[model samples]
Target: MVRPPHLFAALARGWLAVAVCVVSADLAFCQGADTDSSSGTVVKAENREVSARFTPMRGQWKPASFGGDGPVSIKKTESGDELIEMLAGDPITGILWEGDFPKENYEIRLEARRVEGFDFFAAVTFPVADEHCSFVLGGWGGGMVGISSIDGNDASSNETTQYKEFETNRWYKIRVRVDEMAVTCWLDDVEYAVVPRGEHELSIRIEMDPCLPLGIANFMTHSELRKIEMRKLNVESGSTDPAAVKVESKTEQAN
Candidate 1:
């Protein structure tokens, strides 16, 4: 009944992973948690609770009426996954998550795939306290990633601008974290952008006004979106807990 030291270490690692996934019935949610930022700052994504989920069961994701946008619909895939599909958008197409969401200390997670076009496929607009901004994915001729309008600069011209090659028809995991301090984005576990909130003015373009507090859009692109979930985070920093602040009271005052 003897075991090697390496075997014991392997078992310990396995148990640690299981402990992390115990937060949700869907193991993918925990396994796919986002962390870190482009600035090399560590971010803890565990111990959070799911706040909102945009799915067929929710019945609140509506096609954005951005004038000549595409046809959008919810359909069950061959794999039995429910997804939102946007097709044939002349210039822009989008869907709005028609529900209240946290303005700060929350995370947005989704899977997106470009079916056609060479523009951004999953541009997520979310609230940053009183204002709103967007995480543009596969934009600017299909390879730019950044937040829209930071201190009056578009994603293409902002400090958070980044580039990553994207393949059409391939699903990409995307996560965005909006905390009291900064807004960070991750693409497939790779840190994409991180912009401090206080140092910059966060906003969306006039074309993205309809998105408002929360929504996902495409720029002349046909795309499929699925498993869009919003999560409320608890941990903040080592010295101070983010939840210690009266978030509910703060929200009411802002409103």
Candidate 2:
């Protein structure tokens, strides 16, 4: 049962070498998890930096252009930013962005503030490929965020539904990006919802069709919108580019 001193030393060294190897392997595995395998780059989803370009759409919007039973007004603020307001009264009152809108792979951003009322302040209807969808902000008594009519269900009944407190008279920056894989939304630069694009059918409700192509509406609420901009996203680079084409604004009377 007695081993030579040299044999004992050899066994100890062997165990030490195995321990070193195990520790090295674990460190390597942990490092790999923080990297993007395909790109061989460090992955940083927490605060990913984005580079993007934006091009301004021409023609100042006129109140007469955006027709609805409720009052719609477009005024230039003291700071020279265009402000689009919809007064609360009718069930639905909105103003369509009268310009050519991209079908998909783009991000739309704007600043919205609830001036009055208790319902949704900004319901943005946009295009998702051939179909259409709406980003309902401050809905269901003013604290819901989600996409409408995913798989024939309204935003309140869909998987992307989320609730966040929204204060009236305070501006919030809202952004929505639609790509081939998913539709992601951010409020004040914080992510709010990520709806995967797959078997689900994306469509706007019948009442929202009037504001389609691209539009902002209020549901029995008074809302103000400004700094409305849209940029085409470059999928591979994860950046955005200014749209090249510019179209004249058109007026469509509300039905």
Question: Which candidate number maximizes TM-score?
Answer: 1
Model 1, range 1-255, lDDT digits (tens) per residue?
001111001124435333222121222223222333332223234333222333322467898878889999998778666689998587889988787678877778889999988999999998888999998998999998888987788989866777888998999998887777567777886556666557778889899887777889999999999877766754335412121212222234367
Which residue pairs does candidate 1 place in steric collision?
Answer: none
Q: Estimated TM-score per prediction? A: 0.72, 0.71
For candidate 2, write residues 1-255 as lDDT tens digits.
101111001123434321111022122211221223232232322223333455554354433233344788777779666778888846878877677778877888899999998889998888888888898999998898888978898889877777878898999998887776567677887666666566678898888877777888888898898888777754534321111111211221122
Model 2 TM-score, all chains together: 0.71
Per-model CA lDDT versus the true structure: 0.70, 0.67
In angstroms, the error of model 1 at 12 is: 13
| Candidate 1 off by > 4 Å | 1-43, 46-57, 77-81, 237-255
Worst 10 contiguous positions by lDDT, candidate 2: 1-10
